[model samples]
Target: MRTVQYELMRPGELLAEKERFSVAYLPVGPLEWHGPHMPFGTDPLDAQAVARGVAQKIGGVVFPTLYCGTERARTPQELQCMGFEEEDLYVVGMDVPANPVKSCYFPEEAFGMILREYLLQIVEQGFRLVVIVNGHGASGQLATGERLAREFTHNTPATVLFTRAMQKLEEGDQRLGHANISETAMQMYISGDSVDLSQLPPREVPLKTCDWGIADALEFQGLGNAAHTVEQDPRDATAQLGRRYVENGVQRISDQVLAAYAELEPRQGTKA
Candidate 1:
């Protein structure tokens, strides 16, 4: 069977794929707490599934999932929004101060260097249209992607696109928060055993940021209120819902990648 997964493909297969389609998908996220019910690698897991779904629709290689991302520390105002008095452990990214296991978070500058290395490597591999499947929703992460997208697209022959997963894919979809129903549903869609709603608190119980998975965290003062209760039920999450998100994400990304590929296909290429 054919595969779009980069790590699984042989060199010959990879080269053939590059000639056929000049697109590469990089599913990026960090290993952070997502709550009790969901896996810790929820972000990248969701990203990989969606990226592969899109690749199959169009044509591309799904790079190995990047489980490292950057986040800025919470400012006084941001901390205040989260109902925190100090920044002792209220740093940004989903690794709440409550969780015992810390996440793999890189400094912004360090992450930028690492990301640039990957981007350059992918481009040098002959992929003219590279899609950065952003799984983590950190402010610093977004800024880095935006900045690099412009730099690489303008300076190089490639066009880099940094897009968040499940953003505006569905007609009335709410913002996909950290380990929220959407993320949980997407994870459920990928693997049933990957999520266990039973592991979570009772439906009526409000899950705090430290519970591990913030399946239903709602903003009260700032964003992702630490004092907020879960607004949705993780039990309501189903593989079917996950499938819808993945399918919708695939379609939206497929459209963009296909368009870019078409425009760049006319460029001079020695192979096929």
Candidate 2:
């Protein structure tokens, strides 16, 4: 009912919104293949939905989701631990093989520059409080965003908040991962029948065995078995469960955003 989408609103309407909240939400994610069962826009979709939800709770303008993101590459040896061959193709974010269409990812340095510019533009648009709702969790992606948030806040008058759309759940809750249950459920809630968990094989088929899907139970050189990286069965996820996660994430992110927004100095109107 209420509109927070920045691209959808007129300049006058956006100015009124800025006058009221001076907050802007950027949903950042990459255009990577989630799985054959799911859509490629899964990550950004999740971020966009949550961004709108949080913006509704706390007044703000939600930008059309940013499809650019960063990621880390896993060498042949590393992927071997995940049941791959000894030496072969390279894998990028989320244990996905970087063959022809590896995932839409930029180098970390380039990604940092891209995000830095986005933050600068948001601040330039006269938004005093900026919220970056990240959906992709590649280690490099996370670092780049955090570094930019700190830099932007320290260098500019505007305050920036970088947070994950799939925020951490309570202790013992299911861990989120690439195309995992948590994500699938969120997509189910957001896109309805667009994301068919039915496309996934029967319950007997293991996710780790798949070629382009989830990589459950990963083990790194220094890191032990990281089951949380890809935990839970998507089939077990329901639309209701999806709603619960989405709602909880919006609540948590909104709480953090509101508390921080409150501490910033009162807005002085949009820039001329």
Runs with alpha carbons beyond 4 Å of true place in candidate 1: 85-89, 169-171, 210-227, 265-272
TM-score of each: 0.88, 0.88
The RMSD (Cα, Å) of candidate 2 is 3.6
lDDT of 1 by residue, 1-272 (tens): 47999999999999999888878999998887777778878888888888988888778899998888888876766555554565465566656666767778899999899889999999888788899998877789999988998788777778898887766545655645667777888888898798988887777777654444363324523545446545555667778888888888888878877776677656435222
TM-score between candidate 2 and the true structure: 0.88
**RMSD in Å for all candidates:** 3.4, 3.6
* Residue 143 alpha-carbon offset, candidate 1, angstroms: 1.0
- Candidate 2 Cα misplacement greater than 4 A, ranges: 75-80, 95-101, 216-231, 266-272
**Model 1 steric clash pairs:** 34-212, 34-213, 35-212, 35-213, 36-213
Q: Report lDDT per candidate.
A: 0.76, 0.77
lDDT winner:
2
Looking at candidate 2, the ten consecutive residues that score lowest on lDDT are 221-230
